[model samples]
Target: MTRKEQTRLQVLNGVLEHQVTVDEAAQVLGLSERHLWRILAAYRKEGAAALAHGNRGRRPANAIPLGLRDRVVALTQKRYQGINHTHLTELLAEREGVVLSRPTVRRILVRAGLTSPRHRRPPQHRCRRQRMPQEGMLLQLDGSHHLWLEDRGPWLTLLLAVDDATGTAPYALFQDQEDTRGYLSLLQGVIERRGVPMAVYTDGHAVFQSRRAGRDETNRGGATQWSRALGELGVTQILAHSPEAKGRVERANGTFQDRLVSELRLAGASTLAEANQVLGDFLPRFNQRFGVPAAQPESAYRPMDSELDLGSVLCIKELRRVAKDNTVQYHGRSLQLFPSMERTSYAGARVEVQERLDGRLLVRHREQILTPQEAPALAADLRAQVAEGPVVVARPDPDPTDWNPPQRVKTPVIPGPLAGDSIWYEDPARKQVHRDLVLAGMERARYQGKRIGRPRVSERPEFEQQFTVVVERIGRGGLSRRQAARELGIGYATLKRLLDSQEKSCTKPATSLSLKPDTGEDY
Candidate 1:
């Protein structure tokens, strides 16, 4: 019996035995005198059983039938095995016509042990930075490498930017890899659609900064290519020293890995373009579901500067000095700058060559775009075409009788006993005699100090082989040189020197592990 039922039985017994007054029973039970009287009368006739609820063991008239419940569970196990309870509920309503709320589905699945809450590690205690007061105040940017298309296609990288204040993803695109051009395309999309953010938070990749370990801070003060582009647009770039510092974007990447991958699979997206098209349709629904309102209703984003040229601001720019003939060299292509009205000649002047995102080149002089033509190659180089230009010399015919060459002399040898009258035939005894004679001569020459042939790697000291193993292991495992040296019983400085030499000897990169800047397509 419930505690309420037991309490009522006690109250009625107290009143019937005259141990407690009727007024006291009513006050204790928080019921009126008249209501308590009715209950006491029923209790006296019906006994303790009357205190129980009348509908306790009965199903309601509106309850779903047993067959429907069984079908729902069976369908979940068969067709939508991995679907979560909430998504399954929607699918059941739409496809199976079994209307149910998420909580009801969750309770049914939990009873069957088909689903359970996810287990997560306890969060570390750290002071969290508060979100900005307004949207667009700070934007966290990152790229996630994931198998977004599942097995239908190759792995792709999703470049995204999330507004820190509102938790809204303003820009995201599917690309072949995480590269400068991809970031540029993302930046352009954001600027054209959502306006300029006040500041961007990112990690210290080579695309954002120079990553020279031994160089002083002052030496790396000059802006990188991407940084310079951002500076030209008046956007502040904030570099994060650790992953925890950029927690917003990092968490977004994790969430995308979970939700976006499933969405792409459901959409049957098999290529980058197909994934992007699906993403375009998915972002709006996602933002609507996950975006939070900022403290202030007003947005913090500023309007783009009218004079800014996005084409010039979002490209690879390199400074080249013009030669006396008005030629500038860039990536082995010589571009001849034409004279404009502002200047008679650009000879000996430094000009900027911009490689636009669309793979077009533009030469800019004093903030002015110039027409560039391919320069004619010089005559001194044989690689330059000379068929239509000039002939250096005339061909002369040679007389065969006038050409005298050196005469050859032949020496004859008498055939040996096993010669078989063939030049290739040789006796085994004679070969063995020649080998013994060479060995004897070498033994005699040893006293005079002589060595031949290259040394074998295995012949080196044992310590050197260990050093090589430790170095290669460190490179693969990403261990520090000091830690590796300590474990291998070697000096730290010696191991460091060996690593430096190995890096110098490697013309190509050992692995795609370093945060190097990527120069490729924007899409």
Candidate 2:
């Protein structure tokens, strides 16, 4: 007898001999007291054999007949060869007139060895993260590149965003490629429909994180246009370190690759637009099937701010400084900003140019939208076409008598300009002052029969003193003293002492900071 049958027999015998109460026997056998009484009667009538299940050795009433099972196995090997259980189940019902559930078909095939049971490696234990308590707290975002239309069309990428709390997909779109405009369009739809999510979890793609090396976090800020738009909208973007880190979206991609591809295939969608139209019908059904309710009934999504201009925020923003001709250049295209109330001239002013998702360009300054027209292809001629006002042109060749060519003259100086005087210096202000001093020194030295040439850098006390002053000024302006020292060609300790003395003299009491040597004397 089986272990369960042996245990039942032991419990029944114990109750019969009075060694255990009926309640105790029922508890040990995990059966109700009423059920135990019936078993007790049966046990007394038929002995220990009564404890065996009645249907243990009998065929199930609902089981498929052996003949049907054999036919299914044969068809699986012949007609429906290589099809999966689910697919075979579909074909059997539709083509062969054999209506059987997927599990039933799988069992029949497995028993006949026509198909082996699917084997998988043991899953490694991972601590699964819990979903956010409220909807819209976090949305896992990703893109799945697959042949969504199967053999009917080209491969496409589905830009997807799934809410963490509810497992609801707020947005998904089929795009030719995963580009910035697709994401911008996706976000625009999401904000208009379900409001903006608090945060988005995405992978470390170039769209989210900077791929360029050597840029600090600050310099790398808003490196990608998508990220810049997100920053403007005040939405936090969290980039996952690995694919498994965003397992929700990664697993969702797998599901879409399996189910969405099939749905698109069945719908006979071959183009991007046709597939997107099918998604509208598919998403609602998908959510109904897979979406779960959030832990909290209240949504975490804050109502859209009244001042939130989604059109302005969900776009590609590029900072362009207006050229001297009152024009802004972006992506090889020059745009001329018309005169507005905000300013008559945009020349030399920074204006934000937004390449809207709809493929229109908008020029904005201080939240004021400026009317921009594509400047003529001849960018050099934009100033004359549309600028602050009407252009006043002088004839290319004016009357010879009216426009006389000016004459050039020379101004004499005490000494000719020095080589060091004309050379570009990092500190122009210091360079000018030193140049004047050198000229004056040269004038005075001529009287002493001394040569007028560049001073030796190491021996020039004035140059060293001037450099120290420049370094000290830079240090006071927030540059680290060591960095200032490196730029100024001085020792780090020397710069530190100079800065310390200057700071102490300026902010604190004018007291000397003396250092004590090992001999107990102040240096």
The candidate that wins on TM-score is 1
For residues 1-523, write the lDDT of model 2, one tens digit per residue.
9988888888887887899999988888888999999999998999877888788789999988889988899888876665567766876897789999999998888877766333445999999898899999998988888877767888899999888988878888889998888888888778877887889998887777767643534324536777777777778989899898888878778767766765676677999899999988878877887899999999877667887777887787767789887889888787988888768888888778887777889998877888699776664354324432332333243222322333322322222133333222133333444465556666667878875653333444454456556654774786766667567555666555655665656554322323211221211
lDDT of 2 at 313: 77
> Across residues 239-291, which tens digit of lDDT does each residue of candidate 1 receive?
99998898888887876776677577667899989999988887887688789
Give the 10-residue window scoring lowest on summed lDDT in candidate 1.
514-523
**What does each candidate score in C-alpha RMSD?**
22.6, 22.2
After superposition, the stretches of candidate 1 with alpha carbons farther than 4 Å from their true spots are: 1-83, 86-99, 111-113, 116-119, 213-221, 342-345, 373-523
TM-score of 2: 0.55
The models' CA-based lDDT, in order, is 0.76, 0.74
lDDT of 1 at 295: 94
